[model samples]
Every structure is written in C-alpha cells, then in structure tokens.
Target: MNYKTFLINLDRSPQRLADAKKQLDALDMSFERVSAADGSQLTPEERACFDKNTAQKRYHYDLTWGEVGCYLSHLKCWQKIVDEKLDYAIILEDDLHLQDDFNKVPELLEQLKTPWSFIKLGNPFKPRKETPVETLARFNLVRYDKAPSGTCAQVVSYQGAKALLAARSLFFRPVDVDLQWQWEVPIKILGLTPYVAGHNLSFDSDIQQIDQRKNKAKRSGVRLREQLRFFYHSKLRGE
Candidate 1:
C-alpha cells in the first residue's frame, strides 16, 4: 500500500503523458513524472551522456542505446524509492492507459514479495491471459525464448532495481538495440520472471513493426552456438 509510482515521460509526447495522468488520477493513484531531458535533478555529465546516447532516436526508430536515457530515469526513481525506504514501486511511461476500475495495488504488492522478478502492464499487443498471476518463472538457461511483450506496466522491487543497475555496467553489448523488450534479456539473466497476465482494461493495440529483414523470423545460428559456448564460459568462470 506504500509504493511510489514513476511516470517516465518524454517532453515530445505531451498528449500521451496527459492521457496517462488523467487515467491515473481517476484511479486515485498519485505519481511523479520524470523527464530524462530535464537536467535540474541530474548532473551535467549525466545529461550530456544521455544526449550523446539518445542523439537520433524517436518512438519507433530510437536505437537501443537511446533507451539508456529511459533506463536512467528508472534508476533515478529507484533511488528515490530507496531514499524514502519503500519496498518497491510501479513504473509507467506516458503511453499506458489503465482499466477504469483497476485497483490491484494489494495484489501487485503481494506478488512482489514472491520470488518473481517483474510485473508488466502495458503492451502494444492484445492480452495473452486473463488471470492475475500468482507465480511466474525465472528463465534459467543460455537460450532464447519467445516471451510475452509489453513491459511498460511493471512493479520494480528494491532488489530488482539493484539488479537492473548492475546490468547497466556489466552488459555492454549492442544487440537488439532497436527492438523493444530487448531489456528482457538482461532481466532474464538477472533471474527475473515476468508476469504472463493482464487486467480487463489496458492500453494495448495490435501493432507490430514491419520486419524489414526477410529473415527476421529465422534464428541466428548464433543462438545455438552461443549456448554451446556457455559451457566453456561457465567452466572458465567455474560456475
């Protein structure tokens, strides 16, 4: 009952932010909006880095590193949560619209107490399941799997926040930069499990990007080869 909300937004998307605010207010939930471009709360070096990182990206075209700014917003919010000594918080972007009668705060807090890693709310696709999740699985293998999409609606625990921060410095590879949900890979490696469910009302649409590459669906033989190398990597690390 005592969690904070992070309303992450971009100044360019005023309409979306207003919409999300209206919906949250109707639900009686208070949130603090954080803009990545706003430098008052962030250091000059940090602001410059974000600008350098997000240089040429937009809603659908921003490359992966462009997301570093968004991740920075989440980190700032996490710090606030820790400073306030709250257990966790629900994070949102301006694009999400919640159900009119959706007040699952208690339910969400309960789930966070479990071994689960994260709970997602917003997506660009239709809901995959109708029930509130009581349990979710932590993916434990060096293999790629098709996960449910839309990570905007989420609950971030204190541990989850720390783990994400840990990933920022450690996983520096630039694969899947333009693809949303690419963060899920690091989240998975962090041993976080995502909820496979949704509520009655959510801001989801059945929109998908054009797979410009004709071979988009084809798995890069790299995945299988990478799994094989995990054994060697594991042995070298003595894992």
Candidate 2:
C-alpha cells in the first residue's frame, strides 16, 4: 500500500543520516527524517515524568538521559501517525541495513491475511514460544508468545499507535519494553523472521557511548520475577 516512512535521526549524527540515505537511495525508497529528541534536551517536566513513570526500576538500574530521550523520540513518531490519521507507517531508526529486496516490503504488506496493529520487520533474538509461522510469499510472520524487542524497523498501524500512546500515557518503561509487554497494551503484534531489515552493527548507539551492560548479579532476581509473570500471563492464563 501507499504508506509513509519515517526515519528517526538526530541532528548531531550526520554520519547516520548519510548512511541511512545511502541505503534508502540504493533501494529507491523514500522517507522523511523525523528529528530525534536528544536526551539532554528534556525539559524539567519531561525529566520529572521520566523519573516518576519508570515501571521497571528494579531492572532499569541506571537509565541515562539519552535513553529517555530516545523513548520520547519514538513516542513523537507514534503521535505523528495518530495525529495524521494514516492507516499505517513504516518506522525505522537510522542504523538499518536493508536486505537486497527490501524495497518489495510494501508488496508483502498488501498480501497480509489479517489486519495487524504492529509488525516487526527485523529479526528478534528468540521469540518466547518457538511457535510455527504463517508463511507469506517471501517471509514468515508469527504472533510471538512474547512481544519481541528492538525497534530497529517495524510497521505500526494507526490503532497500534493510539494503543501504545494510551497504554504508556503515564510512561515508565523503555520504549521497546513498553511495546513488548503486549498483555499490558493488548495490541496485535506480529514478527517477521529472516528480517527484511536489520541493524548495521558498525554504527554505535546514540543513547550509549560505551557498552550498556546490566549487572547480571543484580538482574537475576528481577529476571526471575519477570519470567514467572510472563509464564503466568502468556501460558497459564492464555492471554
């Protein structure tokens, strides 16, 4: 279908913009650059809300200002989609490496059997259930047992945008986590395996200067708690 594309880019990162443009140009794809909000630019009120709304504080050990800014940037895109009344939009971060035939994704979307609120284009590490996939022409689509992480590339429908906006109005978790906890929001989320678009590993993260690793020792307790919660919600309750 005739969908609009938005690339989340920061003004300070010219190299990322250049690289994104080069890839899109190669595929003859068009997109509009949605200027990303820098974490350092968060106003006093935004910062206060960021501090107050954090849901996973136990696991969210030291979320930097940049991470909050990144979350807000994605929120801005979702708002744009809802405000514009678009059927759906393709959302991409600046660090994508599109597959050779990535340009044909629009055609793939046209053939979807069911209307989807969210469709993840990039491959995830390991979706929760290891369920069978409903094969499309050139890709596999599955409603993962767990909401997949990574917002590298995806398509979000107007309803999905609205659902997400409403779900996180009080706003506490990371953007990816906000979307991943599907039971909290109740949106239709689908994942595409053999990713049509993936991230370029060479590009460093705008949110982190160094490797952002969580302390495994500290994470064990929260991780176990979350695992049980996921099990109860996803399998036991069959939600």
Instruction: Say which candidate scores most in lDDT.
Output: 2
- Candidate 2: RMSD to truth: 2.7
Cα displacement (angstroms), candidate 1, residue 225, comes to: 5.7
- Say which candidate scores most in TM-score: 2
Q: How would you encode candidate 1's per-residue C-alpha lDDT over 1-239 as one tens digit per residue? A: 46788887766557667888888888888888877433234355654444323222212222233334445665666666666766777776665657643455435346443364444544445433333333323322121232334445666666666656555532222222212233433453111223322332433321112122233333345446544654464455443
Instruction: Give, for candidate 2, the lowest lDDT window spanning 10 residues.
Output: 210-219
Reference-based lDDT, residue 74, model 1: 59
TM agreement with the true structure for every prediction:
0.56, 0.88
- Report the lDDT tens digits of candidate 2 across residue range 132-189: 3577765777777666677889999888999988876556666777676687876767
Q: What's each prediction's clash count?
A: 3, 1
